[model samples]
Each structure stands twice: as structure tokens, then as C-alpha cells.
Target: MLIYANRDAVEAWSREEAPDNVDVLIRRASAMVGVATRMARYEVTPAGLPADDDQADAMRDAVCAQVTVWDKAGIDPTAVETEGRVSKTSMDGASFEYDRAAELSERTRVASTLCEESYDLLRLAGLIGGRPWQR
Candidate 1:
């Protein structure tokens, strides 16, 4: 249910077509989890109860996996600066200065931890459905 727009195509489309594709993409990504849950046999109760643990876990895992893939594909998770002062020519640009490198490393570690946690969470969720959890 993940929709990745071609960056080049999006830019071209923005010029010729409407700019609403951005919003549409956002809406689709946001709704993917709910759609996935329903397809997975989860029914939301009227009491505002959270989704079944297993389903939630699965969703988290899927999200984490998606992030992991993007990370491995060289997308910087800490590139927040908009100023042109910092160079973006290489992967080892100023963005990875000593302090930034350490922070990025720590963040990567944390992301990996979260990925594992999501898997464990999914396992727990499966238990709620009286199904054996598989890793």
C-alpha cells in the first residue's frame, strides 16, 4: 500500500497538473495502515480500544522496514538544514561532521532497536488473536 512518487515525475506534474498530488500521497500513506488492518481482520471497537496488539505490531514492523529500506538507499535522516552553506555533493559531506556522525550512528542504532521492538510487538499482537506468533 506504499506509494512512492517518482521525484522527477512529481516535479513535472506539479508544473503541468495540479499540486494536489502531494496531499493525495499523504492521504494514501496515512490510510494504508487502516486499510491493512481491516484486511488483516481487525475490527475497531466502539470503546476507542486500540487495535489488536498483533496487528499494531505488524503495522509498526512494516513501517520500520520501509524506513530501513530508505535509510539503506542513502537517504539522510538528519539532513534538516535548508541553507546552501553545507555541501551536499557527497555522502560524507559536512552533514557527517564528527558530532553529526556520532549522532547519526546513535540514531541508526536506535532505529534498528525500534525495528526489533516492532517485530516483538507484532508477536505480542498475534497472541491477542489466539494465534501463535512467528518471527
Candidate 2:
């Protein structure tokens, strides 16, 4: 008593879903790198690690690469407070970087989960009679 739909429909759906999942993953990775960058900067400002300007620049460069990936994926880079500076705000008399590390971590996890789910969906659709690759 089961009715089967067209194979093309399922294949189309899987293809449509995969890009969205990949986009989410890319965005999450970008945000995580951004937060990590801000944290590194904060640590440097307070004389925490690296203890030198050159090392800090290197860390910034790594973060910038992540930002580039986000840009390519059509995700908005974190907003800058100044033309060439990260946003910093004073809250409760304490300076807080706009980069929310905890939130970024959570988002990255969610994006990863989505990616796994999307992959499983694709596999299932293929097993359930999706289209074959043309090449």
C-alpha cells in the first residue's frame, strides 16, 4: 500500500539541501575563527600570550583567512566598529569584545550537525532511488 514518487524529485531536493548545509557550515567556521581572533587580540592587549607584536599580527592574519572564506560563502563578516578595527564596547565598566566566543562555538556546532544530517539525507535519498550522476 506504499506509493512511490518520482526519482528526480528526491534528487532535486537533496541537491537543493546540500548547498544550504554547506553554507551554514562555512558561516559557522568563519564566526568561530572571528571569535578566536578577538580573544587572541584581547589576550595580547592584556599582555597574556605571544608577548610580541609580530605574533599578534600572525594570529590576525589567520583570522582574516577565515573571514575571506565567509565572504566567499556569502556570509557577512563581523561588523567593524571602525574602518579598520574590531568593535569594542564597554559594558558594566568592563571592556567587552563584540565577538561572542560562546555563541560562535554553539553556532559552529549547529552548523556541523546540519552538515552531517545533510550528508545522511543525501545518502538516504540515493539509496531510495535518486538520480545517478551524469559524469
Candidate 3:
């Protein structure tokens, strides 16, 4: 599947390399696109509709937000494991620690959430009707 948001757009929004794992990111973004479109009360075209500028930006930001999620994990989010030590381990008697993923930045969290809300991002970005959202 073709990603609506290009690498440049993702880089501009994220300032990081787009994931080399294109298929995984594309799959995630595709699902979100449906959710976003639905929240906008818009039906997706059977052949796929081109996004307007604001919608494209939102899509770019949203995809980069997901890439950030993987980046924070210090492992390819889409990779499969064959064999490895567990992320958590116990010592001698009872001491143990677990690795924790980094927290997502506020901007990424908000951008992803906005896209998920569909109507919010679409309306706020004026990709939908060029009018303020009804209270």
C-alpha cells in the first residue's frame, strides 16, 4: 500500500529517519486513516481519495508519531525475535529489574491522538468543512 504521507513530510514533522520498515508503518497508518476518515464522518473512496494539504500534513504527523513510538523502544517495532534474553531478569534471591520503553513526547502523543479523533484533526486543520466544529 502507498503511504499518503511522504518521507519528506515525515522528516519535516519528526526530524528523524522514517522507519526502514515501510510495510509495518504503512499498515499502521492505513488503519488509522480509516479511523480518522470515519471520525470525520467522511466515507473513503473505493479507489482511495487524495488528501488535501491539511489532511496530508496530519497524516504525515500521525505516521511520524508512530515511528517515534518504535524509535523510543530501541528496537525495530516491527521486527520479530528468534531468541534472546528476556527484557526482565531476576538475580540471586529476589532482585529484578525490567527495561522500560521511553515515554512519548507530548507533541507526538497529541498528534497521534488528533489523527485518531478524525473529526478533531480534520476540523482543526480545516481539511473538512472550512468552519469551526460545533460545540
Candidate 4:
């Protein structure tokens, strides 16, 4: 699937230099946007972007906003995972501490991830939860 926002747009969105993992971040953000916007209905170009200029811009902005939010949270969606380990274990000594960071990444790991700002932008553009939502 095509990424809704480009590297330059992501930088411009946050007014900061993107991290080295930016390319993967963009792809991940786009996937999430695709799922979120699946319920949206809009005219599309041959490239699969919204036909209207404003709607297209909104899509791009929403993707960029998702990237910005994920970056700020220090969650790298492209990170490789290791074998699953016991999240909670107890013996003579009780250990309640678990991998909280991993939990945060879990939310970002899926294509369903959607930031609040991104949702708002898509909703405002009528690209979500409106009309017939025809792909």
C-alpha cells in the first residue's frame, strides 16, 4: 500500500528531524491510516489517494500526525521482536514488574493504531465514518 505521507511531510508535520527509522515509520503509519480510513468514503485518483485536493491533504496530514505521535512516544513500530517471555512470574519472591514498554509497542505494532489527531483530521475531511465507506 502507498504511504499517505512522505518523509518531508513528516518532518514538516513535527518541525523536527525524523529518526533513522523514519521510512518504516511512514509505512507503518500508512498501514494504520489505511485501516482507520477503511470506513471512509471518498473519490480517489488512480494513485489511490483522495481526488479532492483538500481531502488528499487531510489524509497526508493524518498520516504525518500518526507518525509524529508514535515518534514522540519512543515506540518504534519496526522493531524486531524476540521470543515471547513470561510477562509475570512468581516464586518465593513475588515479581509484579513486567515489560511495560513492550505493552506500549504492542499498541503501535498493529496496523490498527490511530492517534487522536489523525482521527480528527480524517473525520473532519469526511474520510471516516461517513457515507457508504466504499473502500
Of the candidates shown, which would achieve the greatest lDDT relative to the real structure? 4
Cα lDDT of model 4 by residue, 1-135, tens digit: 978888899999999998788889889888877887776678889988889998889889988998887788777766634334447878888767576666554653533457768878888887786422332
- Give one digit per residue, the lDDT tens place, for model 1 in 54-74: 454355444444344334434
**Count of backbone clashes, every candidate in sequence:** 3, 0, 0, 0
Pick by TM-score: which candidate is best? Answer: 4
| lDDT, candidate 3, at 68 | 56
Tell how far residue 46 is off in model 2, in angstroms: 2.6
Better of 1 and 4 by lDDT: 4
RMSD of 4: 4.8
Give each prediction's root-mean-square deviation over alpha carbons.
13.1, 22.0, 7.3, 4.8
Worst 10 residues of 2 by lDDT: 126-135
The digit string of per-residue lDDT tens for model 2 on 1-135 reads 111112232234333322333433334443443333332333334434334555433333333333333334444333212223346889789997665665555444433322332323333422112222210
lDDT per residue as tens, model 3, 1-135: 536556666566568766676556556655655455444543344545444555656655655655555444444433423233336566777767553323333334433432333444555654444322241
Better of 1 and 2 by lDDT: 1
- lDDT of the candidates, in the order given: 0.38, 0.36, 0.50, 0.77
Q: For residue 35, what is the lDDT in candidate 4?
A: 82
Off by over 4 Å in 3: 39-47, 74-123, 126-135
Candidate 2's TM-score reads 0.25
